[model samples]
Target: MELTYKNSKTIDSEQLKNLYNDVGWTAYTKDIELLQQALLQSLEVVSAWDDHNLVGLIRIVGDGLTIIYIQDILVLNEYQNKGIASQLIQDVMSRYESVRQKVLLTEEAPDVRHFYEKQGFQSCDKGDLVSFAKLN
Candidate 1:
């Protein structure tokens, strides 16, 4: 299968919702309107498409200058384990290569850590940094 990537923020909400659902991120898929608004306001977005299908996406938020937070990076289950996630991340890192800080909050999993580490991300613990978050 051929995969195409785009750096765009014009994705349809329904398509975004479906992809989120496919990955079991029910938290976002449950509120399509909120999801759409969040996507609309993101500083940048990189998405992967399998022809007409939206297969994966990575969203960023924050000013382009100082710090950029990787809000979400998801690939449909069937589309995982390919180089899609890596490519998507490379695109973002390339765009923000000069930014001082690039951050992401994700579940603590060995595979997850390995994946990000492969992309040149150092965990907070390893880097002697601390991260805190508040979810409401």
Candidate 2:
């Protein structure tokens, strides 16, 4: 399979839908049309395509060259544990090498946390920036 990675500058609406859903984030469904606007300038959307399909993806949202927040790391179930996530994250890291801080948040799952650690990320005091939605 041919592996490919591209940034937000190259992504259109259709590709966004495919890659976002490929990572198990159905919540993005309602936001499909808004993704483009939400991801305005300075965001780098990283995606890995296996020839004919989008298998993995991650988005580095940040103010170019300073600090970056890595988000939406999704690897299709069929492609999980096969190093596609690793490569996708690595590629994103490289693309934002100019940034002094790179961050991401995931529900406190052991396996999920371990995956991030494998990429050299350390757990730290996140401070007062986290909030959750209240389902009515």
Candidate 3:
């Protein structure tokens, strides 16, 4: 299937819900309005689409000049491992290449580490750095 990528913040509620639910991110799907609002306020959102279907997305937030955080990067389960995630990451990296710091906090899994490392991200433990977050 042919895929297209674009820098867009608009997403259909049903499409957003379905994509997040397919990836088991039920918290986001539980409140579509909040999720949509978050997307609207993000610094940038690069999305992948197959025709009208939302297949993957990478959302960024932060001061675009100094730092950028990868707030969310997800691909539909059926769309995983076809280079969609990699491409999404690459797209964001290219867009923020001049930024001094790029960061993301994800579940610590061997596969997850490997994926980000493959994209040139070093683990916090590997460097003189640490990160903390407060989640509800």
Candidate 4:
């Protein structure tokens, strides 16, 4: 497969929905309009495509100067383990290489932690930092 990546903020709702669904992020797929708007509003986005098929994506939100938070990174289950997620992250990190703080919140799964760790991320405890979130 000739995979290509694009740093774009625009994605059709249908395509975005399909990609989110394919990755089992049904919570996102359930609201295509909201998802589309979220994609449009993100500070940066990197998407992977196989021809016309949307296969993976990552989104970031922040002030673009002080802190950059990686909001989401996902690849189709079939596309996982092929380094697509890593490449998307690499692209983001490269673009924000000068940013002071980079952050992401993810489930505390071993494989997930390992993946981020491999990409130079450290757990909050390991770094002597604390993270908190409030969801309404």
* Whole-model alpha-carbon lDDT for candidate 2: 0.73
Q: 5-122, model 2: which lDDT tens digit per residue?
A: 7654455667667666766566775687666666564377667777757677777777867788875788777878989889988887776777788877777888987888899887
- Over the full model, what C-alpha lDDT does candidate 3 score relative to the true structure? 0.94
Model 4 misplaced regions, further than 4 Å: none
Candidate 1 ranges beyond 4 A from true positions: none
Candidate 4 lDDT tens digits, 1-136? 7899988988988889888888778998777888888988999889999998889999999987889999999998888999999999999898899999999998898999999999999899786899898877
TM-score of each: 0.96, 0.77, 0.97, 0.95
Candidate 1 on 15-131: residue-level lDDT in tens? 998899998899997788888889889999899999989999999999989999999999999989988999999999999999999999999999999999999999998767998
Give the Å shift of residue 59 in candidate 4: 0.3
Per-residue error at 92 for model 4, in Å? 0.7
Candidate 3 — which pairs collide?
none
Query: In model 1, where is the ten-residue run with the lowest total lDDT?
Result: 29-38
- The superposed Cα distance between candidate 1 and the true structure at residue 117, in angstroms, equals 0.8
Tell me the deviation in Å of residue 60 in model 3.
0.3
TM-score of 2: 0.77
Can you tell me which runs of candidate 3 are displaced by over 4 Å? none
Task: Tell me how many clashing residue pairs each candidate has.
Answer: 0, 0, 0, 0
Candidate 3: deviation at residue 70, Å? 0.2
lDDT of each: 0.93, 0.73, 0.94, 0.90
lDDT for 77 in candidate 3 is: 94
